[model samples]
Target: MIRKSRVVLLVLAAVAAGVLLTAGFNVSPIARALLGDKEKPALIPAAAGLRMVPVDIPQLFKEVSPAVVNISTTQLMKFNHPQMRNPFGRQDPFDEFFNNFFGRMPKEQKRRSLGSGFIVSPDGYILTNNHVVEKADEVTVTLLDKEEFKAKVVGTDPKIDIALIKIETKKKLAYVALGDSDKLEVGEWVVAIGNPFGLGHTVTAGIVGAKGRIIGSGPYDDFIQTDASINPGNSGGPLFNLKGDVVGINTAIIQGGQGIGFATPIQLAKSVLDQLKDKGKVTRGWLGVYIQALTPETAESLGISGRRGALVSDVTSGGPAEKAGIRSGDVIVRFNGKEIGDEHELPQAVASTKPGKTVEVRLLRGGKETTVAVTIAEMGGELGKPAGGHDLSKNLGLTVQEITPEIAQRFDIENTKGVIVSGVEDGSPAEDAGFNVGDIIRQIDRRPVSNIAEFTKSAAKFKAGKTTLFLVERGEARILLTVKNK
Candidate 1:
């Protein structure tokens, strides 16, 4: 009876202790001790690590926005219609009746467009796209402070779509420094400042999506693509790197793409900036050689270890290349000490060089490398000469014949030295490889095929499933064609 009474007193005491614990009593440490577990220290975050800081773009915008100006152009467009009434003065019934019999006189219409540009110099030089002010009657530039000035076209390069304009201003203006576009890397942070949609001084930030993009805008299509928001009014605006230097000029955008935009590299603009500013024109060096890209199959057939540089298909008669002993069937590996990586690169390199400057040209002829020093000539010239020809019947399904004196006179071939293709079998390898009936085969597998004996010898060396490159003269241009022998 005494033991039972003691157990009842202990149970009552335990219930009171449980109520105290649930009511916020300090029991965690006591419970741990009772369970033979060690007490853990309270968790406090460490404070020694560096924290992420946001990019400060407001200061950048403040410094660069003043240089970005709005460009508005007025073009006088002409239209002709017989039934249209004149906008000026009253319409005459006699004029309309006379116009019904003959054609109506052309009417002038004013077309207005808006775009963007950036000041490139403190003395009032501005850089913009050529299409913006092309054929424009008048152009006006509006600055950030709401000041307006009349701008004049200094020079335009339609091939690359770049132009330089200038405004006569007495006071010094803010400008942006040109950056080295060749050093621009993909994924680097960039900012685009422009007057998009006529919205004044808009700024957007994005990373460089890619570099050296060929969007087929022109012959020189090296562009910098970015994900930054660029609109119609953004054309000719400057694309700036993080250091506030202008690296690219906004030029084009993909129609359906969300963020895809293209810009002309500033490096190309700098190459001709002095010429545009001073002469109001650009003069590019010309090598007088028609070149094509070297494909892997073409390089392999020629025994070239790597597919690099430009393949010369034709050398203009009396041109710099012809005078320098450079010939067709030669692959140019380097020019003026710069290594040529693509066929497109050579043109840009050559065009950037000064005219009449003698430069070394390294080429691979018959799998042997050689160098020649040649002086570059001014562009915009024409020359022609005829190559020898002969015909042959081989596995490739083409028939060739030698160019006799009578045959040369009939075909208008000068200094006839190659064999002319007389026939190409339908759906044969030759036809599929772009060979025509009038094409003259001058070289086969880099070997000259001047006569029937040479043609027969070269044709005998062709193997099935192996590529055979042919130096063909079609019309005035020399082109290279490759066929996989069947």
Candidate 2:
């Protein structure tokens, strides 16, 4: 009987709250005027008898909503492709029919996602997320007063996922000031205003969850994480400080989780924005080498304890690194003016540099620290493909077989198809053909050859002085390729 009474009292309390919230409660005269005397009732601010100098969200909204414009984009996508697939995992048969009639041409997919952005300049420059305007054939920006205008993408950086766009509003547009995102403390209050889940201009409140979080969005993943209930369609919106300055750009989230969301710190976005506003594209420095992060064993080999810095795995001939005297097995400790902490940091540092600018690169080679001056080149522009590598077994001679479960069942061998060196006698061609123990011959003359008879037939088909393509399936997808006198 006591439990029943408590439940009834709780229900009564909830009903009273609903009535008080919707009973024209906590509304100022100006709010009533703007809303045309229409009763929203649910818009009752939490504190009816609020403190004199409390956080005035509605006033903040009035100033912010003008700069917080809605962005909608459309792009052409290949019909039946991943981008054009229906949200429910079904495609309209009509869509496929249109594709067949139009050849391989892409179908127009109106991926209408709503996001929030803010104007940065009086000249109609706007900043948003790369995901908002990237690959967009058309973008439309709607202002607070319901004024809609067409927008053009100025530039975009996929690495940081920030984009710059422009529109000719023809009037002095409202804008926001950029605050130092690096100065934000973990417990500082931040507000997120966005079109989350298609509910336009929704506001959520939370504090900075953490800083310098690496969510693996890109090579440079130092994001400012927050707990402000951001959902889909909030990408590219501004995360604001209580002072109403744009501090961060809301970027990503972990799905099916609570109290976990992330935003790109505005400091990085400012760099990208400045570049895009001045130049149509960003130019980055290029190094002609592939690098691998060092493992503990590799760190020991490199004479380092913690295995820091990037280890050069390969050098491109005539490339910037090679020409600058950079070589494989060297660890890059610094680039330009910044100290490289690890392999991942190197890319971001290089990408920030201007093309054609000669920069100092520090490296450790042969246990000796050295510095080399490398002239930066424009990244990814007209670079030719490198030649294929050499194979020793093919240069002399080799024969092997692919060890398989079925073959293992037949040949009574312990392992999979390894090249079985056949006919290796004293001073014989097989002996000359670099044959080794348990070598599996998976290919001959560019074709796969299994078993002794198949190997013999394939070897006979190859003419001397001609290159034979041998697809030797070695252990675990490893290929033992050889080129030798046919």
Candidate 3:
């Protein structure tokens, strides 16, 4: 009976102790006594070593926003109807009647637009997008202190959509330093300061979503993608890094897309900034060679080892490439000591090179590697044109013509060896096979076709409903296409 009573007391004591521990009673001393706690080892948080230092964005904006400016432009647009004519000049009877009835359509209209810019110099040199003041007759810049100034268009490069404008001001102005955009990593914090929707000096923060993004804006399509809220007036605004340096220019946004924006890397702008400031235009170097991506299939067909370089489709006659002895089917692996990774990289590198400067071009020809010295030329004027011809294959929808001296001079073609494609019937087999007007037919089924007679003879042997290989020169590039004979 005594033993049973002692067991009941011990059970009741355990229940009471548990209730006391659950009801906010101190139990650490009791645990320490049982667990032999050595100064109670400090508890470590899960994210103790992985915490990121928060960026002081407010302080960053305070230092950079003064340089940001609001840009407004006015353009005069003229409207002319097909039948509308000057009342003082001779007019058709029907045109005169239409004008008299319509009371002379509104002669002109004024277009106004708003954009953003940033001062890059204390002397008031501002950088903005070329499209902002492209055809603007009057440009006004408003500063952070509500001061306004008439800005002059210093220079513009429409290809890359960059403009340098100057505001004549003696007052001290804050300027943002240009940062190395190439060093900017993806996921780094960035801030965009602009006048979105004409709302003055709006700031948005986001991380660099990606770099080297191609959105088909132009030939130089390298853009930095961000999730920052960029709107219409944000065009030409400065995208600043954490160090208060301008790293990118907020340029474009996707319509109906949330949090998708694009900025032009400041590195590209810096490349032409001096030229834009001095020459009032950007002069890009030209290589005068048509190039295509070296795909695996193309490499295998060319007997090349790997697709690591740009494949030369065609070399322009009398141009830099032809003068340098670069031929069609050559793969350019290196240019001016810089390794060419792909076809896209070659154009950018060549364009960035100074015109009239000689550069070394390393290429592979027929499984042999060789280097050639070529002088770069200024990019301008139309490269080539099509020749007049007669229909050679109605079923194939191809028109061929022999290259005559008259035709060569008329079309500005230096080499007159291959037959030119004059036309391709729409929706025909040849058109579907990618045959275009102005294509020079060089070979059919591995047989050379130098003229109309050769082309007709080669094309006549094509079997109906059989696919035939064709090699053609188009726009300084040679390409192989397959056409299923109809």
lDDT at 107, model 3: 81
- Give all candidates' CA lDDT scores: 0.85, 0.70, 0.84
Q: Per-residue alpha-carbon lDDT of model 3 for 97-169, expressed as tens digits?
A: 8778886568898999999999999999999999999999999999999999999999999888999999997
| Model 3 per-residue lDDT at 339 | 99
| Total backbone clashes of candidate 3, pairs 3 or more residues apart or in separate chains | 2
lDDT of 3 at 66: 93
Candidate 1 runs further than 4 Å off: 1-54, 81-106, 381-394, 397-428, 431-463, 473-477
Cα lDDT tens digits, model 1, 1-486, are: 999999999999998887567344555543433443323211122255332111446767888899999999999998766454566656867677777776545577799998999999899999999999999999999999999999999999988889999999999999999999999999876889888888788998777899989887776889999988889999999999877899999999999998899999999999989989889888898888988888877777766778888988878878899899998768999999999987888989888889889999999887889999999998773434633333456688899888889989998888578788899999899998889998888888767878878888888888999889899988777888999999
Best by TM-score: 3
- Judging by TM-score, tell me the better candidate of 2 and 3: 3
Local lDDT at 52 for model 3: 33
Q: Residue 410's C-alpha lDDT in candidate 1?
A: 92
User: How many residue pairs collide in each prediction?
Assistant: 10, 23, 2
Considering summed lDDT, which 10 consecutive residues are worst modelled in model 1?
Answer: 37-46
